[model samples]
Target chain A: MCLKSVEGIVLVVGDNVDTDAIVPGRYLTLTDTRELGKHALEGLDPSIPGKLKERNLIVAGRNFGCGSSREHAVLALLGAGVKAVVAESFARIFYRNAINRGLLVVEAPGVSQKVSDGDRLVIDLESGVVVLASGETLPFKPIAREVLEIIEAGGLIERLRKELQYGRG
Target chain B: MVNVAMDSLTAKILARASGRDRVEVGETVVATVDKVMIHDVTGPITLDLIDNLNARIPKPESLYIFLDHYSPSPSIPASGIHRRFRIFARTNGVINFFDVGEGVCHQVMVEGIVKPGEVVVGADSHTTTYGALAAFSTGIGSSEAAYAILTGRLWFKVPEPLYVRLDGALPSYASGKDIILSVLGILGQEGANYKALEFAGPGLRTLSMSDRLTVANMSVECGAKNAIFPLDEVTLDYVREFNTPIDLSSLSYLRTAKVESPHLTLDLSTLEPMVAKPHSPANVAPVPSVEGVSIDAAFIGSCTNGRYEDLLAAARILKGRRVSKDVRLIVTPASKRVLMRALQDGLIKMLLDAGAVVTPPSCGACFGGHLGVVGDDEVIISSSNRNFVGRMGSPKAKIYLASPVTVAASALEGCVTDPRRYLG
Candidate 1:
């Protein structure tokens, strides 16, 4: 359950990448996360899904996942095997969705400008530092203990089962 | 000791919901959820999660399910999704299940179910639309929605509100759409990220219920957690129409709560019609600045506009005019209630005479769901919120966000035109 280090090649995108750009409303009918993955980021660029083949991490500028409350956006990213997302910031709803889906999203200011596509990144979830291929280190705010626990438990489903079992006493 | 006095309206609502004396900004609280709404788009997925966890709804009566997105089931898969919602509603003993043609979820929720000071969470993002009624409502993802249904609680980090002061009466041509688009221009898309927009001022008395709803609905375009309008006489009057006995004095305490300093002030008198150009809601310019940008289609619908008042305004401009041959003018009401009222009032007939095609009440084309989707490289003027890439149809298509009146006026000229000229 320990999320100590996640290493992957990074996918770099610019500012204001919204949920609609992540997955359009037209594709929302598909309930399968794997089916959704094929269309991931297709709204932004038709070739984005192809680029996710080798990259497991994304570095984005400010206000990523800015529109819509659809969990499909998180499902799509996860279905595409996106291990983590490092953005300058996230819209509140998308952040909550990623956490509930057990997707690792880090808010690292200046990371988008510092990283390039295909660069390897080793993110230390416990230490809140992102190690770059250039041997540089960028720090990010650590995820809250409660939220990290939910992620470690695989998602909100497990947490809810425990809460329901304990009867909220 | 916490400073319990001088709490903002959002702080007060969160405190009450969480059963705390006071909650500070940045502090997380597990607040009791007052109302929950799920639509066809998210309902099926949420039910799946429920089944996976073997969870039963703690309070089925508090949850409302709507089948408005793919109301008639445009495709087989969509039909299956609607069927799943129906089965789930029946199995859970949910009484507030709204079937197809119920209009949009937000509009129906505002019609009666939402009350001031309650915390409402919906599966759709525009749940912020309820804040026009002074509710602390916001949107959430399906998984979290499932959790809320199972536990009747949701967690929220108290947000520091950006206070806005509005003064002066709106011009004849300008409506809430312009006012909100103007706000988005100043705040940009990310300016209000993770913060609440608390609106209050002398001008609160000037706006109608419909106008306030439009403003609150689009607050999310600027990435606000929620946009709330304090309870006022206008809202009270609207709620009273539905015969909901609401105490005016009991809610007056919220009006007295101390709000922070004004973050942005807008004079409705000086405000002109505004439009958000394609690719972003923050890419806004005045109607005059973008005038003469030819359009292939014009739409008046979605949760943003499409109210009865919105249609009446557009009908006034379109009563004698015919839609330009170059444009396809489509009008979809926000809900069946709105559509029925428009039909009974002759607004629908007037729109038809003007060559506008009126469709049933659905989300329709605003999110590119169905009907009136544009072609590649085409341009459209929409009364709906969000002009993000590929929002209406093709990613290459340009969408302009504007008032219903502007969409109507643009339908006549087949280009982006100001509503002011037609108002007279």
Candidate 2:
């Protein structure tokens, strides 16, 4: 989790990178999220998942994860050991699903255009800052404090589990 | 009058569900759910997570499960999904299980369980279809659904309302599918991103409840969180199926819950039957412009336009005519009730007699799961909600989205021809 600031290599892609491109629909029936990760980006670039061995941050164009709202895209990215996804904009349902599933995503307008493929950048979720390798810093409107708390707890399910247990106690 | 109704239905519905006097956009509140639906595609994932939590669904009445994605089980893995859904429902005492071939989840939800002004959530994105009947329904992923299943409460951020005003009457051959397709054209791919689409105006009065459902079903194509129409006699009559002899005309909630917006008005009188080309729903074109695009198959079924009326429209064109020799036309109803209704009205016989194979109610053809998947380089004209690359088959296969009328006409011609040519 990128709860605090960390640096990693960035993978750059273009706009409207949809769910089909992330993980093809045929592999969706796999119930386990970890298994879903193996086929990540099989449609667009079959080698992207395996090639993600070193890259932890994905910077892409607008409406990343657009199209049918399946959580498999998020699960696949997580399974591929992706630390975060940054794009100019994201599909509505995918954004919510990413939040609930504890997938770190940053919506930074110029983020994708600024970084080259394999550019190592330092990102801090708490500060909403991305420090580029060129020494230029970009700022983003930070996610709400509550949303950060939920993500820090490893998503809504884990947060609710704690809340429910506390209520029972 | 309609403008005030459009003020914000999301707030009213969420406030009531959360036991708050009012809620504003961006405030996330956990609200009580009227229904929690999971389909064959997303159900197994949700059920598996629930088992880990060691929780049974809190209220069986509010839990709905369906197996419409792969009806009759196309393969062993698909059958495995059905078994998992069945086991979960049986163990949790879920009373709203609709086994394979019953119906698509959206159609079954509206016909059997959804009521006006309730908060409904589902594992599937198209679950936003319930908003047509005045429910605050939205799609949540399987993870959120698992949380809602255990607690009967789901978190919602009240989305801002974007009014899609409709005026004038739909021309001949134009159905609700065209109306929504036109909206998608005007709004583009992400035009309504994160907003709730509120439909209003005199054009709605001339539209049927089925039309409203079709419009609501595809609102997600424009990135809408929910698509809703105001409550009127159309809604009252639809609700009569679940609760009869109930007078809702004087209900204050009806006035507040109905969405209203006058900002973006569309005149249906001038609108043309539309089609979305390959890659995206927003890649729209008029029927005439895209006509004669040769196709190998035509499918008329999906949660988007698969209703009794849609089947009837297709049958009208296929009656007394044969589908082109090379083109295979597959028609699947949205629900068993709709299939039975079509049979009673002789629509099924007309389609079958036209050499159009009318299959059981399922979402197979729409999602490329089974039934009528097209081969690489082959073209298909379909009435399904999406045509994103590889949506119906090989990423190389092209799927064009149109109304049932256009699909039927295209089937008869073996190409993407306009239905107006056949109707006239």
Candidate 3:
């Protein structure tokens, strides 16, 4: 369940990336996560996916994902290889979805200003550290211990499986 | 602090939750769920989570499931959700299952399922529409919704209440949609975040159930839990038409819980048709007051304004005329029942003959997820809630919120214009 830590620069955005902007209303029926990934952030900037194929981090303002409670938005970001998302705040649903899928989402209040696009950065969720290529290190309040356990176990389903198995003995 | 009438469902819910203290920004609270509701889109997901949790359903009567979106349009996935919902309802012995053509979820729940002074959680954000009937309703995620179904309890941090008092009678062609948009314009998009909008005063008496529902439906756009109105004979009569042998036991509880005080009032007699301009949900203006704006599309639907009255109003304006060649008009009914009634009354025909494309009763263009999405640089006049940038399709697209008459008129004019001229 361990994921490879991804490193890159940060792209800051404001609150609320609604579903219409995530994949557009036209492609809602498209269940394929891969195809949906290509269109992620296409609403914000059409070039986000092409740039993300190389690797990047998204730093957003408060309430980063605020519209419809669609899991597709998180799936699209994860499928696009978005290593981590640092935002002042995250929508309750989106935050849970990202954690359940083992995606790294950090709440760094001033993180949006500390990093700019193309400023190379490194994120280590395991170490609870974000290292800017500029040699500056920022520490984040780690997720709840139980949540980290679930993320480390790959997701809720996997964590539940392990818990059930342990209980069976 | 001064006292105010606690007649609003929001006030009652808050009063009941006052013991829990405040739920600060970025904090969580878990409270017992008094009731749970779900619609077609989120129902299947919620049921899946419930099954995965392996929790036996409790108090089936308190769980309400409605098939409003995509009713009778039955795509494979939709059909699958419907089938699964039926199986789940029967196996779990749920009593409040309303199938296709029953009515919109929000309307049906308030009229039949939701009781006064109770906490209700639904998977759909518009579930807050039920607050109009003196109940505390809010939207939750599928996982949380599943948790509610499992334990008959969910967590909620107590939210502060925002009091909006309306005093005067509403002007002609001015509806609750305008009132809410006007309020949203005053209060920015997040002005009432995590708060309950307790709507009170004489102005509420001038509005109908449909109108009240419209106001409550859009409360989410402002990030409030719900906009609630006190229950009166108007609400009770509406409910009586749908359910028989009314229970009077709760009436005494409702009366004993009343808190009386002076109200802050908003006079709406001088109000005009309000519109939330595109690029942002909070960018609103009066229809006649705005000018120099053109439109490429016009839509009327969604849980907010897709009711029978909304359609009839649109039809009244659109009958015997055609939409402008440059304008694409799309209309979707909120529920199959509304669609059937519209069809029976020739409202659908009038819309179609007037060049409106009638679609199935799905969420449709409201979320900009599917059906009638505007293109880049396109400007649309819509009756649906929220005009956030890129909410209807392309980020470059613009959405203008207005009444059904305004939207219908705009479709005929190919621009954003006042509907009063054509109506008269």
Chain B vs. true chain B: TM-score per candidate:
0.97, 0.96, 0.86
- lDDT of each residue in B232-322, candidate 1, tens digit only: 7787888987666666666775665334468898999999899999889999999999999999999999999989999999999999889
Clashes of each: 0, 3, 7
Q: What's the true lDDT of residue B38 in model 2?
A: 87
Candidate 1 lDDT score relative to the true structure? 0.89
Tens digits of lDDT, candidate 3, A1-169: 2654557766767776654566554444444468778878887778887987765688887667655656567668877878788887675556766776666888776776787777787877667777776788788766776567667877755554464457522
Rate residue B167 of model 3 by lDDT: 75
Cα shift from native, residue B362, model 2 (Å) = 1.1
- Share of real contacts kept by model 1? 0.87
For this target, which candidate reaches the highest lDDT against the unseen true structure?
A: 1
Provide DockQ values for all models, in the order shown.
0.86, 0.66, 0.26
Docking class of 3: acceptable
- lDDT tens digits, residues B46-144, model 3? 676667767677688878888765565336766677888888889999888988766667766655667666788887767778877767888776655
DockQ of 3: 0.26
* Poorest stretch of ten by lDDT in candidate 3 chain B: B255-264
**What TM-score, computed on C-alpha atoms, does each candidate reach?**
0.98, 0.95, 0.81
